[model samples]
Target chain A: MKTRRSDRLVDMTNYLLTQPRKLVSLTQFAKRYDSAKSSISEDLSILKRTFQERGIGLLETLPGAAGGARFIPYMLPEEAQTFINELVDEVNDETRVLPGGYVFLSDLLGRPEILKRVGRLLATQYINEDIDAVMTAATKGVPVAQAVAQELNVPFVIVRNDSKITEGPTMSVNYLTGSSKRVEKMELSRRSLPTGSRVLVVDDFMKAGGTIKGMMSLVGEFEGTVVGAAVFAEGRVSERVVAKYTSLIHVDTLSSDGTGITVTPGNYETEVYENNNLND
Target chain B: MKTRRSDRLVDMTNYLLTQPRKLVSLTQFAKRYDSAKSSISEDLSILKRTFQERGIGLLETLPGAAGGARFIPYMLPEEAQTFINELVDEVNDETRVLPGGYVFLSDLLGRPEILKRVGRLLATQYINEDIDAVMTAATKGVPVAQAVAQELNVPFVIVRNDSKITEGPTMSVNYLTGSSKRVEKMELSRRSLPTGSRVLVVDDFMKAGGTIKGMMSLVGEFEGTVVGAAVFAEGRVSERVVAKYTSLIHVDTLSSDGTGITVTPGNYETEVYENNNLND
Candidate 1:
């Protein structure tokens, strides 16, 4: 079948979007579309420009037979700020305040649209880093970690509070959780994480940074390096054990009566701008 | 900035891919690309044909001013079968067999590529159904549920074995589990699942469907209806209780000594084909 240029362009866009961070040689595209290599190269140049102008991502091409095109997932600074501001407003609602001053965020976290945006925003910050795995605590953090991992095209590892037989053999570590000073155990399957990995820690929410700290320690046990950490939201803590991390939103206060709350965008925007030298 | 046809095509494809199941009017694309409505229509025709040919999805174009294009994700039967066979082979390994005849699936479940394929395959089955929400058990089932929810573009609700205050007031139910006959409690937040919602239940694995049944009961407690249930893999159970469900893989045997195991593609392919009248 003779494939038209328009058809080839559409199919190529879909291919690149689905295969993010995967390299596809011009020969591969040429063979798949039954077109000349020159035609495929022209198609890719159009894709690259469109993607960049739309803030979809960066379509990087490497010259020579050993190289090809790779789609690096990214989010523009303006778009990232807009999304974070919207997220902050939605999270600032008094209705989301639960008992014990904990804010209900599962609703937002469960939305694929919200998760995708959060994933792109967070993943963009680590695009230049060599991240082997995205790690998170079980239950709540699973969605966030999965989202970020999808953007980075890497597998995510879920650390559990309790071991399950279904996980086979596991390696565990103990850490103190919260100001309550209660010790908690976190474990991961022995084979889930390989040694000497570069890990990115993610969580749905952080308070006192105990869980994040525990994940970092667990990573160390595997002889892995913590590339960085990010959380969807952060709560007030007198002394956060984890000093360096990125967050999308910070909850300033929540009334004991659960009728009032305040939230603002986290250091994510600032960090992203500083790292990439993105202008306001 | 005068928009070129190639740039418009690439941008339109990205827009449609990102906004699955969304009704995007031609005017939206036309305005976004600074192109004429007729040109946008031509671009969509190319996209529609290319999307169909590539098996990326079905680009449905609705007529009239109120009508527009909707991207319904799908998987070709041959592609689905190939993926399932690969998955079956990967899962049949003896190393995955754990104590108590349970298979270690967390590693596969944690993989974004595997999860994305599983999500699309399962979501394709319920594409025509009106699924308002996707529900799952806490811990293990969260990833599968999130992936499916992402494909369907709906919010997912996590049913927990134990209640957390962060989830707010929840509705709970007790269901008898396994041959052990232990009654276990399952709960979901009151606000997470609205009354009379049409929910799809998803899980990583199903032994005897006790957990799925528990999720169904919890859904009922919230006055919601279960549209369907799907599991990544299903194990043998004498006189299966939940008669109606779809599974991607069937674990026929796993030696108690954990040395040998056998697996096969489940009724998923058969059902999908029969439902769609797809030929081999």
Candidate 2:
């Protein structure tokens, strides 16, 4: 399993980029390279130097018991936003994406790498903002919350569709959802959120603003305030409330046919990149 | 924020060891230490060499637009596995953590630093398992997936409860959700997953295995295989598959009385510490 330094780093980076937050041990790398442990060490040094010189990514090493190395991708906020906006434009299919006069974002969330980028794009915006925790409804919105939470170094909370024994006592709310005439129930962990917390709301879709409003109520119950809100896709249903917000992609239905769908991100990437406040 | 180098090295090693898959930037460390970037780099080099000398960990760095550094905590497969089993033991009851039947993982997830360690703990086990991707049902699982995916450097795919228009055509599978009772639908994009892919299934809870099985079915439709399955907590409901799996913590029902829950983590740390196999 002997390979050149260039070969090892290229293959290692490719292997690492494919997996999102997982780790590989030096022993494994050493085995894969069929080289001595000392040689593997040398290769890793070259890889790290290569990374710093390029400014494209970051590599992490874990030490002591239960330790290894992992790689995390860090894009220049502007560069990332550009990619996201382009992706949105490229995905513009007036017929398939925009339906019933709304932009659709389901396709974007389904792609893992793309979702990470989108999440990062949104996170880059709020990192400097005074948001305390990220919040989203259970099920679809979790990925976005996860992505944002990672960057902000904060815990993200989820509102479950129903209360479970595991969740203990919960605060409940009812709200109008999308086209549904009836109000649906949303629950939040009474103990999970603290009072006076600054919350950043995230979700997969925005239909009637019922769920977000419902979460707002839950936040209120906890004495928390909504600092900001964002969604993967926002439907053309009436805007729920006037608040600071952004969208990774937008959905719209322009024609009579339900097949009409167009997806474009709001000015999210541009706004964040222009701020250029990436200094930690 | 001033700390001794020895303590910092140990702490840093422990911190990075848990998230073997994500990269950390020098800027971030420098900020934490109020130290110059150059000084931080020097410290990292010293730490990196120590790890290489001891055959303990690997420090990987990304280059170009994705530049940063990551500390990967790795253990041989046997050891990595043992560590997961040992985690079940650290469930603290006297820590006032119990609120109802749940072990109250909220505290763990709420702390970004702790979450990073937990992510590293899980990532070490799945490294070389030939997993093409990481899969988790939405909500709490998203963060867990994100944490591990950051370490693994692989794409993490999240399944959603409801479909949004932006995803275009989607394929859904009906699964029994114990929480909701009635059959519910979880969806993925028709194009996101390929046929016969090897995927690692992860989630926050394991109840009846309905969602997991359904996810397996969805993967099968694309000819994908489940390389491994993991859970943050194994709760009241029994698992659907008797096959081998990994879990950070195990939640057992002490009694039907008020949803009595007993928390335990298997020998996760010990497993990681003991195995010396594949020592290159």
Candidate 3:
């Protein structure tokens, strides 16, 4: 198809956004759009500048016969902070407070735009960590895991509280439920992950971190290593069982009467921006 | 950030892709890139043509003070067929066959890329429908619903076999399990969908269409209407309970011996392509 440079630039940007972290040589674009290689090169330069200026991501170009351009999707620290702050404000609604100090998150997690932003923020922290898979529990955590997996272009494995017959041979693990202080069993399909895989654990909410810890141990059962853990929100508690993790929002206080809640942005914004600047 | 027209085109495409089906006025883009409306209009013209040539989607413009551009993501009939054909080839594995003619699909549904493609295909059918939300039964159906919901920029509600107190008040229904021929109960949070809302039902797989029917009835309970129903694959059963629905692939035959199976692309490809062409 004959196309103008402006049209090619638009199409190329759309393609790169969808296929993040994928390398596409100029020849491929040249043939796809029936455009000259020089024109494609100029389009890439324009896209790179736009992405950088807008904090959309980094467009890395490799200069070799085997090389092309790869788009790494990330959010600037300021953008990340603004997103989390908006989320924090949204969650501060008293109507969201449930009994037993739990906050209603289904509505928030169910929105695709919110989940995508949260995924981008978390994935930015682990973009270079060589992640092979994203893992989460069956219900609430599935969306978060799927979002992160999409951003990383990897498969996500859902660990279920109950094993269905269709899953075939499964591995089960018992972990203490963080908020309830009760023992609960989680199961994963044996074929979901191969041995020696590196997995990232993500969830919707983290209180005592027992569920994340349970996933960490489950990763070990498959002979896989846990690269990192992330959560959309974490409840402030006297102590957390899991040692290291990143949370987008921190729930510092929740009233028992369901009348008040206090939420603040997590440490990811500062840590990511500072780390990225230091590396640069 | 001062950006050139080339840069503005790239950023604008990225923004429209992420926020599909939403209206963005030309003035918004003008302000975002610090460019004039005339320039933004020219850039949008380029994007519109590219999107059309690549079968990406429809770039609709509303010509008024309240008007702008909306990107509607879609796949052409040929592309949809190719995608479904590839999926059929992937699922045509002997190991996927389980006892009682059940084919394993958790892994396929878990992959972000696969789910995204399936979501886009299904969402395309209902893109013109006034869908308020997407609905599915947990656990396998959540990802499919999430994907469709994401593409539509709407919230997805999960109906659970078991109710959690955190969901607050819920509406429950009982339906016959397609494969087991046993009646089972499903429930959804009441607040998930408001009265008079229109919902699109989605699932990973269908056998007798019992689950989809149940979801349809459940939507009625909330005074909501079922816009449509879609599934990734459907089994070739003697009878299906649901009258109207769309399936991406058809599992024609599954051997109990787990050595032979036949899968084919479903009726969606032709229906969608023909419908879209007629609309055009």
Which of the numbered candidates is closest to the native, going by highest DockQ?
1
Give the residue spans of candidate 1 off by over 4 A.
Answer: A275-280, B275-280
Q: Is the docking of candidate 3 incorrect, acceptable, medium or high quality?
A: medium
Poorest stretch of ten by lDDT in candidate 1 chain B: B271-280
lDDT of model 2, residue A155: 75
Error of 1 at A240 (Å): 0.5
lDDT of each: 0.87, 0.63, 0.84
The Cα error of candidate 1 at residue A3, in Å, is: 2.4
Decoy 2 TM-score against native: 0.66
Per-residue alpha-carbon lDDT of candidate 2 for residues A1-280, written as tens digits (9 for 90 to 100): 4765444554565445434345788888877777766666665555555444344445666654345566555566556757767776765765444445544444455444665566556655654456778889876687677676665656788898866665656788876675565778888877678779999888877766677777887788888888777877666655555254666666666546666555666646645556554424
> Is candidate 1 or 2 superior in TM-score?
1
Candidate 3 lDDT score at position A40: 79
Report the C-alpha lDDT of model 3 over B169-229, residue by residue, as the tens digit: 7899999887668999999888788888899998888989989988998999999989888
Runs in model 3 with CA error above 4 Å?
A: A252-259, A274-280, B64-66, B253-259, B274-280
Interface RMSD, Å, model 2: 9.3
What TM-score does chain B alone reach in each candidate, compared with the true chain B?
0.95, 0.64, 0.94
Clashing pairs in 3: none
Question: Which CAPRI tier for candidate 2?
Answer: incorrect
Candidates' interface RMSDs, in order?
A: 0.9, 9.3, 1.1
Best by TM-score: 1
